[model samples]
Target: MNKIYILLGTNLGDRFQQLNLARKQLETHVGAIIEASSIYETAAWGVEDQPAFLNQVVLVTSELQPLACLNLTQHIEQELGRIRFKKWGERVIDIDLLYFNQEIIDLPSLQIPHPYIAERRFTLEPLVEIAPGYIHPVYKKNNVYLLDKCTDDLPVKKISDDEPYRH
Candidate 1:
């Protein structure tokens, strides 16, 4: 089984609930979720006018290939009422394939070690929590290095008093 890292976020209704639903669906479609990072509340990226998002990273072991995983993630997003109206627009849920066993891929439908992995602090912060030493195949940098290089100044705070999916 290949270990894959997936990042999930939500800014719409019951954000925490949406994230939990995504995680549950992912476990069914993909494989066992080996690790999960603490949830972080962050300002929306790209579509900066939207609401802040609740984000988290999950490390999973799966038998599916990268494309398959991507497809599965999209399915879950759609099921959770995600609508791709604008780039990074607020949504019910967003699931992104962040990395797949240090593999480099650039295809029309998918990219491993997601192209924007180094640019988003929301993604990197949780990634550092779960897999700080995992290397990025293309950049050859670990999570720590990537976090250090990220230029996004969006604040990320861990909700210490809340449960993973409790709103």
Candidate 2:
């Protein structure tokens, strides 16, 4: 089995339900979910005019290879009502493959370690919550360190566990 980190974000529709449905589909298609970070609410990244986004990171153990993981994630996004009308546009759900067993891959279709890991507060905040000491393969710095050094000034507030979907 391979351990992979995935980021789930949603800003359209019932955000909580979208996340819950995405998680269920991911577990069914990707693998068993081992760890998940608390949900976070943050201003829209890249495009600021859209609704605030709810984001979370999950660690899963999967038998699928890296590319297969990417394909399934995209499929899940589409099934959940994602339409790629514009870059960084609002979506019902977004699933991103962040890390795949600490391996670095640079294919046109995918890039492991997610090229933007260190640059986005939304990604780093949840990463620090779940895997603070996990090292970035290319940056050689742990998640906590990357989060501290992250220059993205966006505020990432962790949602209270009082939510119905706290997973």
Candidate 3:
């Protein structure tokens, strides 16, 4: 089984509910959930004019390969009403394959070690929470190193402790 790390974000209706729904959907399509980070509320990263987003990171163990995982995630996003209107536009839910078993994937449609991982605090904060010592295959650095090197001045705050991580 491959240890996959996924990031979920939402800024649309019922943000918390959307996150929960995304988690459930991922568990169904991607694989069983192993670990999840607390929800982080963060300012819009690329397009600053939009609403703040709620983000979370999760670790899952899956038997599917990289492209199959990406296909399923995109399918889930569309099923939940995601329209790609802008580069970093607000959406009902966003699912990103952050890492795939310390493997590097750079296909046109999918990019593992999510290219922006080291640049966004929102992604890094929750990642650091659950997998601080996990190394990035491309950078050869751990989550802690990426968090420390992140230059995205945007604020990432943990808004919910009411919920525990997923199993």
Q: Which prediction has the highest lDDT against the true structure? A: 3
Could you give the candidate ranking by lDDT, starting with the highest?
A: 3, 2, 1
The per-residue C-alpha lDDT of model 1 at residue 58 equals 90
> Any residue pairs clashing in model 1, and if so which?
none
Q: Where is model 3 more than 4 Å wrong at Cα?
A: none
Give the per-residue lDDT of model 3 (tens digit) for 1-167: 99999999999999998988998998888899999999999999899999999999999999999999999999999999999998999999999999999788778988887999999999999999999999999989999999998889999999877876765
What's the TM-score of each model vs. the native?
0.94, 0.96, 0.97
Residue 71 error, candidate 1, Å:
1.0
RMSD of candidates 1 onward, in order? 2.4, 1.6, 0.8
Error of 3 at 50 (Å): 0.6
Residues 80-161, model 1: lDDT tens digits:
8999998889899999998898788989888786889899999999899889999888887798998998899989888732
Kindly report which residue stretches of model 1 are placed more than 4 angstroms away from their true locations once superposed.
160-167
lDDT of 2 by residue, 1-167 (tens): 99999999999999999999999999999999888888999889998899999999999999999999999999999999999988888999999999999899999999998999999999999888889999999999999999999999988999945543332
Overall lDDT per candidate, in order of appearance: 0.88, 0.91, 0.92
lDDT of 2 at 138: 98
